[model samples]
Target: MKKAYRIKKDKEFQLVFQKGASFANRQLVIYYLEKKDQQHFRVGLSVSKKIGNAVTRNQVKRYIRQAFIDLENRIKDNYDIIIIARNPVKDMDYHEIKKSMQHLFYKTELYK
Candidate 1:
């Protein structure tokens, strides 16, 4: 995902966490806040150190980002979304991650 399409700052993540509605499955958790003035959606990803070492965390993040990129066209545009990876995600592959994310989006009605 591009920098413009990502939530990179701590404040932004906190805003989403505090103000947004959340949805989750066993593998992933999602927090989303509608941003009516924004032209497109932006996403933030979180993978705790408790989930793995550096390489594993980075790999999980990459998978999540790629999943978002693939779903960009189908996802609602006027929201800020944050995805938090849970422990079960460490064993999941890219396809599984994507599917789990899709489930969250569908559950939240963010998927078009």
Candidate 2:
């Protein structure tokens, strides 16, 4: 994802966590806050060290970013969305990760 579309700051992540509505499945947790002033959606990804080593964490993040890129057009354009990967994600491949994320998005009505 582009720099403009990513949430990279600690403060921003905290705001979303404190104020956003959340939805989850076994593999992922999503927290989304509506941002009416923004022209498009922004995403933050979190993969804890507990999930794996650096390479594994980065791979999980890459997969999540790819899923968002593929679903860009279908996702709502006015929210700041944060995705937190759970332990089960370490065992999942790209497609499984994408499916789990899609489930959470649909549950939260973020998918259009």
Candidate 3:
């Protein structure tokens, strides 16, 4: 994802997690909150140690970012979104990850 669209700050992640609504499946959990003043959406990703070591976690993040990139134009704007990887996520390929993510986005009504 682009730097401008990526949610990098600790506070931002916390704010989304605490205030945002969330949806989850076997692969990932998504948390999102509307930010009407913003011009675009911002996204954050979290992969726990239980999912894998550093390398696997990074791979999972990359997959999630790629999925977001593909869906970016179709998603509703002006929201903060966070994706958290679950244990089963480590075994998923890019297509599976993308499918899981798309499902979550739809469930959250973030896809426009």
Q: Select the stronger candidate by lDDT from 2 and 3.
A: 2
Residues 1-103, model 2: lDDT tens digits: 8999999999999999999999888899999999999999999999999999999999999999999999999999999999999999998999999888888
Worst 10 residues of 3 by lDDT: 1-10
Of candidate 1, the 10-residue stretch with the lowest lDDT total is 103-112
- Candidate 3: regions farther than 4 A off: none
Error of 1 at 33 (Å): 0.1
Error of 3 at 37 (Å): 0.8
Q: List per-prediction Cα lDDT, in the order shown.
A: 0.94, 0.94, 0.92
State candidate 2's TM-score: 0.98
Please state every model's RMSD to the true fold in angstroms: 0.6, 0.6, 0.8
Q: lDDT of candidate 2 vs native? A: 0.94
lDDT-best of 1 and 3: 1
